[model samples]
Target: MQANQSRKTGVLLVNLGTPDSPEVPDVRKYLREFLMDERVIDIPFPNRWALVNLIIAPFRAPKSAKVYKELWEERGSPLKFYGEDIEKMLQAHLGDRYFVKLAMRYQNPGIPEGLAAFQKAGLSKIVVVPFFPQYASATTGSVYQKVMDVVSGWQTIPEITFTNTFFDHPKFVEHFATAARKYIAERPYDYFLFSYHGVPERQIRKGDVSGHTCQFGACCETLRADNRLCYRAQCFETTRLLARELGLKEGTYSTAFQSRLGKDPWIQPYTEDMVKKLAAEGKKNVLAFSPAFVADCLETTIEVGEEYKEVFEANGGSHWQLVESLNNSPLYVELLADLIHQRES
Candidate 1:
């Protein structure tokens, strides 16, 4: 007990989240919580509420539940299960110096519970690692906001720190590059597509500290200080680093955004469109990467792996492969440890 007491730091690993079950009701509840967040929808409450509750969730939940059912395994959602597994694995790796807990920004094992656990442990400081490689207002930003909201009510708030973005971190880049290398060696992929989760163009602009710089074409090609926080820029930069590591030649690989929601325009070069474009150009074999998520969530496992594959094949492409996520990998655990140590220093 005394030895455990010596650990003054707590680690909270957070992911986007999943429904408690594949049932429609559970999925509906999950969607409600997720879409209702102002950071997510970024609209007036009444409008957002009506859109989510009345139109979107009501109609979309059933379809989403079907997908969740397909995604479910004997152990249930891979996203949640991996979170549980990584929590234990990371704790072991960190040893007695830290306590690690996993939380979802929405749905089961919520952020509040994770923060409460750290508070109960009486840890002097808490380090939050939002399991997103890039800095996005809807993702990492939301996690930060949720953490602050929960901890604000605590009588004695600990010295809490949050990791911003590690898009091009050596360990992170190496992990994805190594994963892609395995696929690359298996066959000759004609083109490489790095498909990151899409956020609205407005969200990117809102996140831009410099007013007019996030124009989305040439602006995103180079990662500068002004655009460092921009999601589109980071995605491009991440691709550049991964491509560099894998020695992928220019024009052979491209970056696109996937899983866009609503009517609003998302970051350009939609993955589906790119898949079609590649197929139209007679590029039969393609290897795709989703580096936005650290875990094998629905986005990675189903959307990119399955849906996009279908799109590619339908457009005359023969091979579509998704390089798996960094779920509970030793290297990823090491990366998390590095983040914690960096925050500590």
Candidate 2:
């Protein structure tokens, strides 16, 4: 624990982590922590472990280390810095009534370190908010588990509560849509693409809400019941809602998935394939949005910003504009403030 000022209510901001450093060894450590999670891998332990250590870690580390180097600035990982900035901004907005600290689920400055900071602050009540906007077993559930792992050992545990999901929060969509419009004003773009992280179809079935959900195209029929926990349907619904808010036509935009890990089939319309399709169809200009992530990370920064950009350019497309992520922008800060206030109310 870093002070011991009693009466502070702690707010821990959790995000997916990054490498401890831009070097290959550190990147490998981060990858191991991230890929080793059963939720992330979603396979029998033996198979997942063998696949990761043998194939992914052996070949991908050096390449990923270079990518990490590109992302690292004077302050280090953008995920860390952005998470910290949001926490600090949210703390100021919430006033001294709370102590805010950022924690990564994997790698350096993890839950242990963040909890220690809060413990030192002498906070007895805590509210944990995972950075994932959508509730997926892999990301949100992982945070939920690790947080419990930390708080379980505490002799003086706070009244801890975990926010399950905020995908449908009005302020969340409003803030994201505002950013989208602001960036593409007067820009000539034919389509808006909302790309969310992908999980296998089987994982979707695992979280199926009774027999009626995870029905994909059919799930939209029961939007009210699924809520935020319906990862597959909600990704489409988020796109639908935001498209409506922006006064866009039905065919003006599309939603797809990115970041599939293995051979097992993930949710369809993969982003990489989607990019090629757009380019092949002679679509010259497109704008992409990744609202599933409130802050930019590897998925948003590299996959959407660069790799997909390469896809469009390679396919003879003229323009590919990525709508910047929310990060610590004013509207996003306001959205967080509203979330906290909503919780209070």
Give the candidate number with the greatest lDDT: 1
Error of 1 at 152 (Å): 1.1
> What digit string (tens of lDDT, one per residue) describes model 2 on residues 248-288?
88777898999887677889889999999999988888889
* Every candidate's CA RMSD: 1.4, 2.0
Q: Mark the 10 consecutive residues where model 1 has the least summed lDDT.
A: 1-10
The residue pairs that clash in candidate 2, if any, are: 3-120
The list of candidate 2 runs beyond 4 A from truth reads: 1-7, 209-212
Candidate 1, superposed: residue stretches over 4 Å from native: 1-3
Question: Alpha-carbon error at 189 in model 2, in Å?
Answer: 1.4
What tens-digit string does per-residue lDDT give for candidate 1 at 191-294? 89999999899998888776889888999889988888889999999999999999889899999998888899988999888888999999999998999988
Which residue pairs in model 1 clash with each other? none
